[model samples]
Target: RKMKGMENLYTLHQEMGNILLSHVLIVRENSKLEKAMTQINDLEVRFKDVQCLDTSHWSNPAPSMIQQLHCQIQLAKIITQGALVRNEFRGAHYKPEFDLNQPKDFDPHEHVDFLEKQHYGEVQENEFPPGHLAYMKRFEECNKRWLNTTIAEYKNHRPEISFEAVNTSLVQPRPRKYD
Candidate 1:
C-alpha cells in the first residue's frame, strides 16, 4: 500500500507517538483524561494527511513504517478513549477517580466513533458525544469477575471487548490471605 505523499510517516510517527505517550498514564476523574483524548484526536487528524516518500521506488521501509504509524495512531486513540469510558480501575488499569469498590465493566463499543472520526477528519453525527465519561476492584475481587478471558474484537471497524469468566471448575475462587 504505497501511496504518494507519504514520505513523512517515519518521522511523523516518532514525533506523534512521543507527544501521545506523555498523556497515557493516570486515570483522573475527568479533565486529565479529557486533555489526553483531545491530544490524541488532534494527532489523528494530522496523521491522516501525512505523506510517505513512496518506497516502491527505492524499496525503502519508510512506506511500510508510515502505514504502521497510521494504524498505531488510531490504536492510541482507542486505548485512551477506552480508558476514559471505564470509570473504575481494575488490575493495572487504575484511575484515581475510582477504587476497587467501583470496578466498572468495560464496554467495547464506547470508543468506536473516536476511532471512526479519524477517517472523516471531523466529528461525525453518530460519534460518541464528548465529555461523556471503569470498574475498580480490589485484588480479592479479581478471582470472581476477572481471572477469566479478556476479549477484544473489532466489530464494524470499532473495538468490541468483553470478558468471559474463567472456568473455575478445577480451582474454586477464594480470597488469598497471603501476608
Candidate 2:
C-alpha cells in the first residue's frame, strides 16, 4: 500500500508543527496566535496533496500517518482559537499584555508560609505587594467569569468552540502560584 504524496504530507506536517511551536508557545499574544492559525490553515490546504490512493491500513503505515496528520491539524486549530479567546493568563497560557508584574523581590520559596496563609485566611491585605491586591481582585473576577472547560469540536473544516462547567464539587479550586 503505497501513497503517492506521503513525503509531501510529511513536510507539510513538519512545517505546521514548527509554525505552532514558534507562534502558539507557552507565552502567546494576539498577532502571533493569528499568524499561527493562518499558517496552519495554509498547511491544511496543502494537505490536499495527500492523495490517499491506498486507503487500506494493511502493511503500509502511510495511511495512518495521514490520518494522524489530519487530527493534529484540527487539534492545532482548536488550541490556537482557544488561546485567542482567552484574555487572561491562567496556568501555562500566559498573555503578557493582560498580566500583572510580580514584585521585584518576590521569591516563591521564601514566601511559601505567607502564600500558604493567604489561602487559609491568615494573611493580612497589607502584607501583599502594593498593587497585588488589585491584580488578585481582577484575577478572581476573571476566574469567576472564564473558569470553564473549553470544548472544541471540529466540523465543516473548522473548529466550533464551546464550554462546559467544570466539576469542582469534591475538591475546591485553589489559587495557583508559579513564581
How large is the C-alpha RMSD of every model relative to the true structure? 16.6, 4.4
Indicate the TM-score of model 2.
Answer: 0.75
Q: Which number leads on TM-score?
A: 2
TM-scores of all candidate predictions against the true structure = 0.54, 0.75
Question: Tens digits of per-residue lDDT for model 1 on 92-173?
Answer: 5566654443213323344344334544777444343332121111433444545655565657755565667778666544
Ten-residue region with minimum lDDT total, candidate 1: 128-137
Q: List the global CA lDDT of all models.
A: 0.56, 0.75
lDDT of 2 at 178: 68
Angstrom error at residue 94, model 2: 1.4
Clashing pairs in model 2, backbone N/Cα/C closer than 3 A: none
> For model 2, how does the per-residue alpha-carbon lDDT over 13-69 read when each residue is reduced to its tens digit?
789889988999899999999999999888887786676655565787767788899
lDDT of model 2 at residue 111?
Answer: 50
**Which ranges in model 1 have alpha carbons more than 4 Å from their true place?**
1-7, 26-30, 54-56, 101-150, 167-179
